[model samples]
Target: MEDVVLIYHNELGLAFRWKNTVPNADYERIQVVFRNMSFYLLQEEISKFSQNIRSAQFYNCSDCKANKSCRNILLKTPLEKMDISLNMQELSKLSDLVEGTLFKLDLQDYIWGAGRN
Candidate 1:
């Protein structure tokens, strides 16, 4: 299974998505990886100079039956939009992670198992 999936929005930028390849992996470890990825993207690719990302979204697209929670992945970007679908608790946790002000936000789950926010 792929560890990460990336989607680019033309010149506006790209987004980093985490794929739940290790279903049984420790959540803390997963969170650390997520943080590392976010930092890399923000510092290396999604910064103000390079491909300025427009939005960031987190969700699983694997065939794993086990439900995974991605609420611990904190995103740091100067993005204008963000789309995330997580449970109320997770959503609350996400709100604390966003460092930049967002102009557009989509918290509703368009995919199943992506808990409501």
Candidate 2:
């Protein structure tokens, strides 16, 4: 958290960016650092990821031999090579995090009249 400007966060994960970094070209991007993985995604990509997570299904793994609970959900990201696995509670938190981030971004846009630009 010290190295990045936190956009939104919860116990599950966060979206952030390195301090003082400027947009390379046009669109701005943020780093979604969650659990053991991280991704640099645009605002549209984040919205798509949030939609995918919301529409995902949860199930119990009948053949799971692991001692931990077998109930989990797998969500595909906007990226082709990455996916996320989460239990019910974790899924909820992640949803909150992403949705909150989107809300914050929208608010910032409104306050700054970004849409009129």
Candidate 3:
């Protein structure tokens, strides 16, 4: 991750961004690349995605013989442009990653007054 600054991360995935080489570079967006997919999103978009993940529901299939960790839940992105298949465990971990990143971002804004600009 030499090209990006890591915001937050866990066993499931991580959120990062390109290193700010310019003094006046924007910090309003971040890259969330993991789970074999990549997304460049704003803070609001990340928040929305976290909310949607928290609200999603999952159910086990009685007929399916696959393991419980099998990917069954289909989660749509905030803009409804992509669908991510995840198992219950994956969903939980992803939720943690997104929400944790958001928390860190918010804490930075609050402590450093980053939101003022």
- Residue lDDT tens for model 3, 14-77: 8986777746546678877668888788999999898778777545566788897889888888
* Tens-digit per-residue lDDT, 11-113, candidate 1: 2222434566746543221121222233333332223412222233333335554455534334344334643234334433333333221211122122323
Candidate 1 error regions (>4 Å): 22-108, 113-117
The residue pairs found clashing in candidate 1 are none
Clashes of 1: 0
Candidate 1: C-alpha lDDT: 0.33
Q: Which stretches of candidate 3 lie over 4 Å from their true place?
A: 22-26, 57-66, 114-117
Better candidate number, 2 or 3, judged by TM-score: 3
Query: Model 3 misses residue 96 by how many Å?
Result: 0.9
lDDT values, one for every candidate: 0.33, 0.77, 0.82
Kindly list the per-residue Cα lDDT of model 2 for residues 1-117, writing each as its tens digit.
Answer: 465677888897888766754545233778877778888889999999889878873455546776443336778898988777777667777789889888988887887896666
Per-candidate TM equals: 0.22, 0.75, 0.81
Which residue pairs come into collision in candidate 3? none
